[model samples]
Target: GESVGLHLPTLSVQEGDNSIINCAYSNSASDYFIWYKQESGKGPQFIIDIRSNMDKRQGQRVTVLLNKTVKHLSLQIAATQPGDSAVYFCAETRGAGNMLTFGGGTRLMVKP
Candidate 1:
């Protein structure tokens, strides 16, 4: 038998601190990965993304890192704020027109 996915239920961080959320995926064929943030009662909002060809990518105060060998992915947020508290999800897609497969989300609790 082989593993197919990974999940984290929650994460807590202090205001002004950095946060790192992790995810693991099974599909080796998946070529694109995306991170999304969802506040309570709202749809998921795109945060950042990285292609399998690259190991890491950066945006505003966020960074996405992918490790294909172990099928791991991580999202780092710098200087977390109370407004950053939300559920974060990682999604994968292999080809055009393919629907994204989303990993179990991690709830980020930011303490003020």
Candidate 2:
């Protein structure tokens, strides 16, 4: 079965450096993609998102890039901070009433 997934289980980065997290989705029909950040004891929070029609989207300190041809997606964080440390997951939705398929999360660790 096709699924949306991440390429890495974890990532470690310096507090002041940039970070890139990658994801891959097998369903070409998925029209919406979202990146979420989950803190240790909290619910997942929305970080950024991109539609299939767009290749990239940017937020305050984050950017999401989509490559439909390769079914690849990535999130880029600028100047990663300790507060930015969390488990990040990618989710995809198709034709939906808010139904989403989530990928395995990638734990991001920011070293001070």
Candidate 3:
């Protein structure tokens, strides 16, 4: 099925180290990319986002890069923290008023 998925299901990083999470999408028309962080028994929280027109975008402690050529997306966390441990998902939308298709997600574990 055409969907979004992560190359790595789980990523472990030492506290204070930078972490990079990768995701791939099958849809070539997806225009908006979003990164989400989900904790146990909770809804996904928005981390950052990038548009298809742009290759990269940065937010507080985080950066999102979009590679339209490969249909790839990535999130980079500047400093891993225990509080950052969660399931990270990449989602995409084709246009305004469209539903988002989310990846299976990668679990990020920040080890002390």
19-87: candidate 1 lDDT, tens digit per residue:
999999888888888999999999999999999999999999999999999999999999999999999
Ranking of all predicted structures according to TM-score, beginning with the best and ending with the worst: 2, 3, 1
TM-score of each: 0.93, 0.97, 0.96
- Global CA lDDT computed for model 1: 0.89
lDDT minimum window of 10 residues, candidate 1: 1-10
Candidate 2 local distance difference test against the native: 0.96
Q: Is candidate 2 or 3 superior in lDDT?
A: 2
Write model 3 residue lDDT over 1-112, tens digit each, in one string.
6799899999999999999999999989888889999999999999998889999999999999888899899999998899999999999987678789999999999999
Residue-pair clashes per candidate, as listed? 0, 0, 0
* Better model by lDDT: candidate 1 vs candidate 2: 2
Candidate 1 versus truth, CA RMSD in Å, comes to 1.9
lDDT of each: 0.89, 0.96, 0.93
How high is the lDDT of residue 79 in model 3? 88
